[model samples]
Target: MSVETDKIEIAFEQLVDIQNTIDTVLKVPKNPGHIGVRDMLRIIIGPQTDSDQEKLSEISSNFLARRQFKALLKSQTLASQTKQAAASSKTTSGQVRRSGDDFDLNLIPSTGDDKLFYMQLKVKNHERFAQISKAEMLFVESKGVFSSVPLPEILDGVSQIMIRQGHPVLDAFHDPEAEFFIK
Candidate 1:
């Protein structure tokens, strides 16, 4: 099944770009949760840093301090949102689950240059169905009419997944070779 997406979220896009950068320059630890920030300058800025801790300490503090501690403040807001999610999240059966993956629906544009992607959609009425539903081919929206694109084999010896804003994704982010992972 194919679904029309809501507007593409810019904040989410920015987050994705930031993650793409982090995953490019750092080393991925075998375990997860965090990247090894052995050299703060190298991790945050890049390898061409001055390699002087005292200077980097100032830069780091400035980055944290600018605009009234914006990074920390933004994190506080995010923390609160998750805190509230637990209470607001409820299903008819019991607790609500979050499947935060970005690719439930796959939207393809007419061509590669197209900015809009076709993907699965969430509708107003069908939010609470606890089952797996599959379709032979997916609905594609373009040219004022719907077309069809067969779903590609999702996992063909490729790293076929990433969790948005999740810790496990850190591994994928740091592996430069993972850049080619299928969306």
Candidate 2:
């Protein structure tokens, strides 16, 4: 998906640039029962363009066409993927049971560059989840020890797994060589 957005400060003689911006935005999705593209164009142009009706109409048509084209492309891609997945549906019993190991946090990489990390966790209760947010002890070599790191900092480090997968989590912000873990 490609989106081209351009903005300019309020000015005279460059009314066409504002029209072009409106023309390009007509490609936004339409659903959930809200305002139409024309109304949105009016909102963007009315206060800034001195109520120019002819320019508004031109901008509206261009933007609407672009939006429809993008929506059509997205719908086609989704339909193709759904069709492909439906055509492959075979499974083995042991293969399915062994898949549980994929979620094990202990299997995550724990070394290199101090930027890569991997961790997996299974939370059984809300209090456990809160404890994760309040992680104060370092889990290294299968033993827990009390530490002095703040709760928010610990949560931020744990959140990195969602952003980057297959990287070892490092402890440069805490102790450089200590291994950190969460349940």
Candidate 3:
């Protein structure tokens, strides 16, 4: 076989060996179920390094924050578009195209006896709001709540929370504290 073919065969064998090891460690049944890459990595590495853990935490926090930001931006854009469409339609036809009362913000039921009902309903359906609240809490705890904190500040606070949670990556090259400058 050619050198490249030989190398590919060796790599394939190694992958099979790793899979067998994982199956053995996990005590897979006669018919093994699917195993994901993260599970395989955990089995191989045994335990993550502090640096690796920190990086993972930072990535997760950034992902959540960015997702929340994007959701907010999308909601605002849609609302603006809806408003513009309604206005244009009204100007053309001299009649309201949509009813303002169609949507109700108040969560009060007809009975109006339960005070916490609205809060519970909001929390149950709005998971993204909960995540944003947690992120905001981290920022407030780190640096007291500001009248208007910038987006970067919020992201920095999320990073700090990850560091405080015992995932400090102190390696020289990948040190979290090291500052990067662009020339």
Give the best candidate by TM-score: 2
Q: What's the TM-score of each model vs. the native?
A: 0.16, 0.19, 0.15
Order of all candidates by TM-score, from best down to worst?
Answer: 2, 1, 3
Ten-residue stretch with the least lDDT total in model 1: 78-87
| lDDT digits (tens) for residues 71-175 of candidate 3 | 333332211111221221222322212221111111111233332211001111133333432322111001111011111222311212112111111111122
Regions more than 4 Å wrong, model 2: 1-117, 142-183
Q: Of the candidates numbered 1 and 3, which has the greater TM-score value?
A: 1
Q: List candidate 3 segments past 4 Å from native.
A: 28-183
Per-model tally of clashing residue pairs:
7, 7, 0
* Best candidate, lDDT: 2
* Predictions in order: lDDT: 0.28, 0.31, 0.27
TM-score of 3: 0.15
Model 2 per-residue lDDT tens digits across residues 37-149: 56534333233333333333333345553344234323322111111111222234211110111111222333555544343333223434554444332222101221111
What does the lDDT read for residue 167 in candidate 2? 18
